[model samples]
Target chain A: MSVEPLNNELINNELIKYESIGISFGNRKVLSGFNLTVKKNQKILLRGKSGVGKTTLLKMLLGFTKPSEGTLYFRNRVIDSKTCWEARKEIAYVVQDTDLGEGKVKNLLGEIFSYRANKEKLDSEKLWTFMRELELEDNILEKNFQELSGGEKQRVGILIALLLNRNIYLLDEATSALDAKLKKKVADYFLAREDWTLLIVSHDKEWERDWMRIIDLETQSW
Target chain B: MPIYDISYTSLIFCFFLLIIPIFISRKIRLELEKSTLEAVFRMSIQLFFAGLFLNFIFNLNNGLLNLAWVGLMIFFASYTAIKSADLNVKKLFLPIIISIAFSNLVILLYVNKFVINLENLLDARYLIPIAGMLLGNALRGNVVGIGDFYNDIKRNENRYLYSLSIGAGRYEAVIPYLRKSLRAAIKPTLANIYSIGIVSLPGMMTGQILGGASPLIAIKYQITIMVAIYVSTLLSTTLSILTSFGTAFDDYGLVNKELYEKSS
Candidate 1:
């Protein structure tokens, strides 16, 4: 419960503003004249029907696509490609499909702490502890990644994001493949974290109960 | 006497021989007749034009004209390389051209200077056909190499991004794809070399023999050309793939979907 302050700080950040942002593909408009303002650590749930541009909004935020119009700010600072990379250090994104790399979970995990920027802060012990907490066995690290079940892959992806130590997490339907028990466990691990902020895109109402804000793509235009 | 002309009259008579296959195909209700006829016509037209051009090139025998002729071949080869490749042209054209030119030129010069020991390395009789052979084979290889590499990366975009996200540099991230595609592309050329005499009489060897050269000399030349083809194919494919990498990805090291012709 005390983690609520950290969530509030994230929600209060001045950079969390969206003005007139919109995107279109071919001739179809996904978003138009959309407006949003978010503060630090605020858990956000983005809900929409298929093809309503929920992914597009996230893509725009990640600099994968540019808005047809509108501006995005991060803590009151204008966000562009360069700033986005810098800000990305504070964000970890986990998509539903765990198709990130072509190696075992351990190899992928080893790569995170191997970066020059992260070299000074490698934490294998902490990662192993988290793996245990997530109910993953040490042997799971040795299994071939392509052979993992969807639930296992989802959990592994979360572990990767967690290892990155980013305060803000962008999760798109991350728990859809998980069983109920594991899903609840994941939800608690994230929502219960003291220093974390999450912007989650999901259709599962089960995972949204703890979210502080809900942005519906169906009702929000542009 | 000519060693083996397979004379004009015999060649003309050979057209009738197609009836054997056509008659058989008809019983099977296969519409192979039209396609066979189209293929025969295209082959005839192509060989006729190629003969005419070769005659002119040989007669002129000037180094500059021969080099220009080779340039035309490279241009055609590069065009096919880029087209067959799954890569986006806006990102791929320049590197491919450079690699094609570099590999072709280097082998062309080496073959001319060392193997044939011609007084003038660019002599038409020596340069034009050799460059054509080398560049032609390299083009086939580049198509596979360039095409396969990018397609592999695109197919495994998630894996690539995961590598980058986890702190692998761009080159390191893509090396796995590079190694796999390179092996696939080079395999055919390598197999051809290994099976040269046992499986098939290579075209250059057969041509030299028909032109009245001794079998020994023809075999030697065939061996040289095969080696040249191997070297140039490796050079061009690797160079082209590596050179194009910089343009194929965006600033974030993610492959730009726009660069590909359509999704691989």
Candidate 2:
């Protein structure tokens, strides 16, 4: 009974594992033999120069891009096309480009909430609160998403990620467009959540918290 | 009053009209002389053969032969739609053919049975021509709809991937794209329906009037045919998009890269 409980604890703590991951674009191998393990509630900030496959790593976790070599695991289960969908359910991903089409913000939000996994998660009160927290105006939701400024679009993307209420977050340049103050505020808000696992890819200084483990892709062994 | 056929001499005079466009092309450097002549020549030869074949089929009026001809039309329609949309014909052909055939048949049979009250449902006179109209519209719609859908997804891949990463299922993520493409597919049909008599007299109604039908009878057929064409176009476009979900997307719900024909 004691041994079983310890094994369960260990298994439960390890949220994600990248076993010797490699990514290649054609003949050029951008990333190779990279490995990382993420524990539950761990905050990891991935730093890399452009084209180092930082974004590719995040996408691989969602099965958007498959690793050229090695395997990825989520919650101790191998992340294949089949299991990645389930993994996506528990992960909130804020993409680098926040182009959600030309629809009105409210309609787009409604469409997102209408998904089967997100059906009951849309709370109007929370939406308003988050919007306010994110410095979004009341009339912003009525405006066309494409008409919004880059900062506003980024905030909206972050707002969506927060509203999803998922434990794991893959934030790719999620705050690049935000002003310094808003960026710090957003980073603080995300960092305050001790139980949230964050995999952030950004060049922002605001995300550099003492508790966050920073991994530089360039310095890592290929 | 019998409908007057174009005499060979008058047809030659009609061909003379092409010289004006050829002259304009040369003046404006449009460089379309070769293509224009080839298109006209191809249309004449194809339609000449079609007229002969259609006449033979009408005389026989066998239900099985008419269905086989309709099947052949569907096959060519599907092939053209895929080719026009720049999709791999081998991958998407089966689903597209099935969708076009199903939608056209359903609307055609319903029109024959309930609207026209035809004694012979598969009579070549009705089946072949009606099928041609329905299949033509559906083919155009499918080209627009399927092409827009896959192209939109490809262009805005980040948005689509964002949805998937946020816990959306394949259908959920694709619903927005589907809605947009379906609207695009049916927009022309809707415009044609609204602007029918006001903008131009439709070919079917004009043909019927020229063939000695009363204006009132031609207008009635025009209305029914317009409604039938609209319904079949919408149905086929919707079914084509849905059915293509099987082959166009892989197990990961990502569009198969191989589904697109590589541009030379």
Candidate 3:
């Protein structure tokens, strides 16, 4: 996992902004009148009950889903179809459902790093170090991802995001399946970076830390 | 000697065999009684008109007319392919038509000129019959290929979306599905080619042999046509998907849910 050195100069610049953003399915309003601003070198936790639009709100930044009402800005530019594709290159997103792909774990990792946007191969030394830290065996890469246990799958997802080395991360329930100890370890690793911009959605109590400010999504409901 | 024509009485004898299915459906509660009769009726009527029109076209022997007939056949094949595959006709019509016409026409003309050594590549007798065989086989292949491809993607949609989420463009993300559907679409034809003489005498070769051609001559035609069908099928299915992809999804890489025909 690559930890980009802290950029004190970028700490105050806005990395993402949501202006009265709202999303709905046909007529059922899920979220509305929501406003949020995330600056560089900030870590924010989204806390909400099930189906209250935490994941949907995070997906809007990646252009996976659109806000039915209000606008979203990334790096001072309005998010649109063209910009969304560009945004994906800079922002690493780990879906709530950690479906990496169906083949071997190492092959999946290989394919992800091979993407033109990835820019570098996976660091094997870092991989082994992180795998040991996350309780994944050296031979785990040989196993099929679909066959891995749920907690193992979550750790792999976290490993890939860190490997991507992007400054911005949108993680949706990324550590929900892990046990308490592993959850605390994963949380601590993410919380260690001072330059990474994290927008995380989780119910895990381990993420409730002093540095990671929590935004109760239920209170922001339309 | 040229093949002898069956008299009208012999035609009656052949139609009589269809009664067995009609009776069996009635006795076994298969509920296929109406469909069995309707299918046979439709087949006979369609073939009767087809025979009459073909007889006229053959006698005229006009190249333009022969090509026009082939164009019409491709249109019907593509139409059947899309409709039976449960896709919206308007959404996929142009691509399927272009794929069917381009692949079948190229293969049919090439076989006539290079394999059969026909001086008149557009000779009505040779072109019309051979094009008909190729179009029929392609129609079946496209139905299975295009049909199975879309359905498989829709079925494993989460897997596809997951790939897209991992920074893959639409083409890169669809590679797995394309590989799978192409394998499925081409397998039956490959089996047909592999087991040619041992498993069963192919219909085209059997028909030619019955029409007084030597076995060697018939087998040669069978070999060329099998190769043509295989290549045409591979191209048609691949092209159909590629071209359809242009309009099948939105810019955000989501499949347009409206592309599927719900009533079907």
**Ranking according to TM-score, highest score first:** 2, 3, 1
B1-264 in candidate 2: lDDT tens per residue? 888999978999999999999999999999999999999999999999988998899999999999999999999999999998987888888899999999999999999999999999998899999999999999999999999999999989998888898888999999999999999999999999999999999999989999999999999988999999999999999999999999999888899999876543
Q: Considering every candidate listed, which one attains the maximal lDDT?
A: 2
After TM-score superposition, the amount by which residue B258's alpha carbon in candidate 2 deviates from its true location, in angstroms, is: 0.7
Higher-ranked by TM-score: 1 or 3: 3
Can you tell me which runs of candidate 2 are displaced by over 4 Å? Answer: B22-36
Model 2, TM vs. native: 0.96
Better of 1 and 2 by DockQ: 2
- Winner on lDDT between 1 and 2 is 2
For lDDT, candidate 2 versus 3, the one ahead is 2
The candidate that achieves the highest TM-score relative to the unseen native structure: 2
Error of 3 at B101 (Å): 1.3
lDDT of 1: 0.79
Select the stronger candidate by TM-score from 1 and 2: 2
lDDT (C-alpha, whole model) for all candidates = 0.79, 0.92, 0.83
Candidate 3 deviant stretches above 4 angstroms:
A1-12, B261-264
Model 1 CAPRI quality: acceptable
State every prediction's TM-score relative to the real structure.
Answer: 0.84, 0.96, 0.93
Pick out the ten consecutive residues of candidate 2 chain B with the lowest summed lDDT. Answer: B255-264
Q: List runs of model 1 lying over 4 Å from the truth.
A: A1-16, A48-50, A75-77, A88-90, A101-123, A204-211, A219-222, B86-91, B152-176, B210-220, B245-264
